[model samples]
Target: MSLIASSLTFMKTPLTAKLNTQLKLFKIKVKQNTMHTLNSILRMRRDIMKLLIIHPHLSIIGGSERLTQILVYELEKKRKNIEILVLTGSRNKELFPETSKIKFKLFKEAPVKAKNLRIKKLINAFLTLSEVMDDFCPDAVLTMIQEPIYLVLSKIVKPSIGTAI
Candidate 1:
């Protein structure tokens, strides 16, 4: 009985070692596949020009809004095949006619009384921008104003995305 137990233990040790080796090889293969997929995505994005333009708000037609409008027009004119997506907090659709790609991150007034609404709004904006960046994966980010929030969020979300103020 003791000899049988010893032999069983010896077999278990080799089986466990073999399982561990297989697990390690599987992990390595998964890592390589992930890297290859990432490289392919990067290469595909590089082939197309995707621009993400962030504006604070376009509720009213101001100088900044006009500049943004002109910039988008000129960019589209220059690069016919370029893809542009405009992100804003709030916008008047009448003023900003291009509604196809313009995304709004509107923050409704919280029902519960909050101490700092500004902070809450900032957090909401950051999260929204992060989602946009992840989905769009823009090659470059163009911000109309000198908003540090956009700059910081863009860098944090995707460091590869170039930001131009």
Candidate 2:
């Protein structure tokens, strides 16, 4: 019985050593993966530029709408690394028929008690836009009209540039 117990204890020493070696190898592999991901993100940050275009409404197709589409098309053609995002509430497919690659983010219409009040609706839209801006983290924001709310929020966001046309 004493000999059997001594043999079992001796066998456990090699098993414990093997387990420790495997654990060290696993930690090394995890560190390698983490470093690889960090390097990839750094490269992407250097290569790509993010841009967001905001429009109050796009329910109708007109000169401004056509111009916006053309501008995005030309910019992408010139700079392949530029990521273009269009933010609007309207979903008129005809206005952007060829913009399959461009990202289209439909603004969420906020509900308010005074539905008839235009100011309240605009305020709600501004709040929604603020949330979207935080998520997108665009390098620049472009909008046509100079809305007072946008002006104030733009200062707070401090994007590279907030151009109002």
Candidate 3:
């Protein structure tokens, strides 16, 4: 009985040691695998040189409006093809020359002078532009016109470039 007890105790010591070693190895392997996956994702994004920018609304106003315009310039400067699909465009469409490849689609266009009824405009605009977006399916959707539409679409869509989509 004493001999049996000694053997069982010895077996358990080695068994627990093996388990602990396996656990350490598994932890190291998991971290390496996670890092490898993250790097691959970043590399894939970098490989994509082409970009589609969808601005839900844009008009000659606000800091966001200015930022959106600047981002387009930066993307274009990087030689990434910029497809500016505006669901509701402003008078600034003329800002980019006709020669530019930037395609402009306007569900609603701004008048010379604008009033602040953007929320109402967005609700109405979404109806017409939804079809356009389905067809266009841009890489990112930038919301120059701050409403819930961009958020809704982006949730289902990936690479939704909030910077200037």
Candidate 4:
């Protein structure tokens, strides 16, 4: 099994300090158990032009969650037609006012000020994403922060273009 899968097994074992420690060791900080489809996401690089990057909050500010911003920038730079649609996990906007452009959009129910209710954010992201997909039809929608929820949603809505970073 891969590191991710093993991590999942460890997580499912139980909820305890040991499990929490294991989750941290493996960086298993996701909102859902949708990671079973990660392998498909790895197969996405075979095609690149039709890409859609997903993020829960899509914040372009200072936070440990800057990986989302990095994903957007990297994809945008590599593919000129990249469209970043944020499935916002935060209640507030993660905006870089000086750098605002048409590249990003949010699907958040409420603005999150802190990381208290992570599961709620993931649920919000999932609910909003279904509607967002119908409007913004892309060949492939991708993400890294939202983990399995984003990956599975992308696959269901359209082709998923995932990458390992």
Candidate that scores best on lDDT: 1
lDDT of each: 0.76, 0.71, 0.57, 0.54
Report the C-alpha displacement of residue 72, candidate 1, in angstroms.
Answer: 0.9
| Local accuracy of candidate 1 as per-residue lDDT tens digits, 32-110 | 9999999999887676687888888888788899999888777776774567888887887776666333444443333
Best-matching candidate per TM-score = 2
**Where in model 1 is the C-alpha error above 4 Å?**
1-45, 99-114
Model 3 lDDT tens row, 1-165: 667645654665777567657867998999999999999998875655443455544656567666766766766666653455544455375554333545566664424243657665655455445555567655556565556655565553443434442
| Comparing 3 and 4 on lDDT, the stronger one | 3
lDDT (Cα, tens digit) per residue for candidate 4, span 1-165 = 477656665565545456567767666545333474564565553343444555555344555346656665565666754445544544234442212222455665656465667766666666666667676555556565536666765555555434322
Off by over 4 Å in 3: 1-57, 108-123, 153-165
Clashing pairs for predicted structure model 1, backbone only: none
RMSD of each: 9.5, 6.0, 12.7, 21.9
- How many pairs collide in each candidate, listed in order? 0, 0, 3, 8
Model 4, position 59, has a per-residue lDDT of: 42
lDDT winner between candidates 2 and 3: 2
| Candidate 2 per-residue C-alpha lDDT over 11-47 given as tens digits, one digit per residue, 9 for 90 to 100 | 6587756765786789899999999999999997777
